[model samples]
Target: MLQPKLKSKVRCTDRDIGEVTKVILDPLSHEISHIVVSMNGSGERQIEMAQVQDVMEDRVELRAPASAIAALPLFQRHDYVTTHEVEISHLEDNIDVTPGEVLVPFPDLEKDVKRRTFFMNFTHVIAFLIGLPMAYPILRFLMKPMYMPFDNDWLMVGNVSKIKQDDVGVQFQYMKKVKEAYMPEAEVEKSVWVLKASPEVLDKVYQDKDQEFRDASGRIIWINKKDFPYIAFSGKCPHLGCAFKWRQHKTLGQVFLCPCHLSIYDATGSVLDGPAPRALDALPIRVSAGGDVEIIDMEFKAGVKSQIRII
Candidate 1:
């Protein structure tokens, strides 16, 4: 029985180094008169001293040295030596085993591992330390509170009791704050009213009649209230709080005239002629429980064409 031919397969790192396979023979065996060698994956074939037809089926045929086959580290036994035809077999099928080796290209493993671990740990510590201060300002700003003193804690009223009813000048005491020991304290002063009108006078004063008042300096001071009884507003200009005396315009009827800037106020405390944002402020007062009179709280806001409406 004729022995079956064998083949081997191998992988080479450098393609420039080709492949080889061996056929073991006795000292006096049939001389390899004409041998055929073929590269398997490439399907290229070559013959020594023989034409292509001379080989058995022109496939699975190779002749090479055993030392050349051993040099390739990555190789398969069955792919090494196979006859072109008849009894095509792998070298591993005939032989029990074939040796193998593998090589990989890389730097030293210990140094590479230590470098990577050190860099990662260093970055982690830096991030933790830096994040503490950065978050402090942000947290402080978000958790802080605001300050407001006069939010919904005060009330305002009108002062009309300062005017009298019998047309007689009346005297009243007014209390104002003065510095006491570097702190503010109440100080009293007496102010005298010159003209007094009864509650019924408001109806007549607000009528179509033009009424005006003035101080000793002939400066227009007061204008009679509109559509009311015994109610009137000071003719002081609010822009700079300049006092004005009331005067009857020979042709214009009645007008309050300011001496400092000649600012004028209408009967309703509205700025009739000046650069003020709004009308004069109203004083707060009311009839006392004892049937006398009392002055209450007074506060004001400025606006365009607005007046301190005594209500």
Candidate 2:
């Protein structure tokens, strides 16, 4: 009469193991026979009910230690870390009929029968040989979301006083190290634009601007005069991930213009007019003691109204 919940945390005598993925049951007796726990990505182990020492406080404890459990015959599932050819073999094993198909479809029983008995067909064997090496990188890319850690690292971009008030805005580019899934870190250059609007200009600019940018109580979203007093935004366009520039026009005076698709943004990083879903991404910045501006360089999910940080 055991009822082990799916995905419950499992542990060994010495250390924590993994979560229960599936509970194998004997249908005739309605008894739990095995607990399938995924140790990590691409590795699973089946724990017999006999080895489960206790199942209290929402955790399954094992009789064996972690090292002992790892050495067990059932724990040595194919991770393919030792070899790449195993991944190609796994890809060729997923040709079974899906449950979504109706009327069982027209049976390719002859071909499927050969695959089930021999584990692979001639075509699959040939494909595995031709594409075995490339499958490793593809598998890493597919599993990136599960492996990559979420982190936000701050880097100083530039000094605020260095950008003249008349310059309107300036773009800063810096090297960023991106950690790839199952790969080493990579150095890539990224850019950000700092909009330099002095308190004098901001006083006149937003004095009579849109009331919608403020709360119902009439407090403006863009504070006129703040410390450091420099506005910074990601130079990437929200729509199509294109590089945008700050350009001044005869009537417009100064605006963030996207040359790729003609999206326009105002001084406070609000969408003025264009097909852009949202405004430019404003960065987190602060001023130093000597009137210098230091910015925490980070990126957000592009083409999204609510800015979600992506680092």
Best by lDDT: 2
Considering every candidate listed, which one attains the maximal TM-score? 2
Q: What value of lDDT does candidate 1 attain over all alpha carbons?
A: 0.39
| lDDT per residue as tens, model 2, 137-210 | 98877887665544434567766656766537688777777776657789888888876666664443445442
Candidate 1: residue 277 lDDT (0-100) = 75
Let me know the TM-score candidate 2 reaches against the reference structure: 0.45
Write the residue-wise lDDT of candidate 1 on 242-263 in tens digits.
5556566565445555677766
Question: lDDT of each prediction vs. the true structure?
Answer: 0.39, 0.63
CA displacement after TM-score superposition, residue 126 of candidate 1 (Å) = 20
Error of 2 at 4 (Å): 58
Give the range where candidate 1 is weakest over 10 consecutive residues by summed lDDT.
97-106
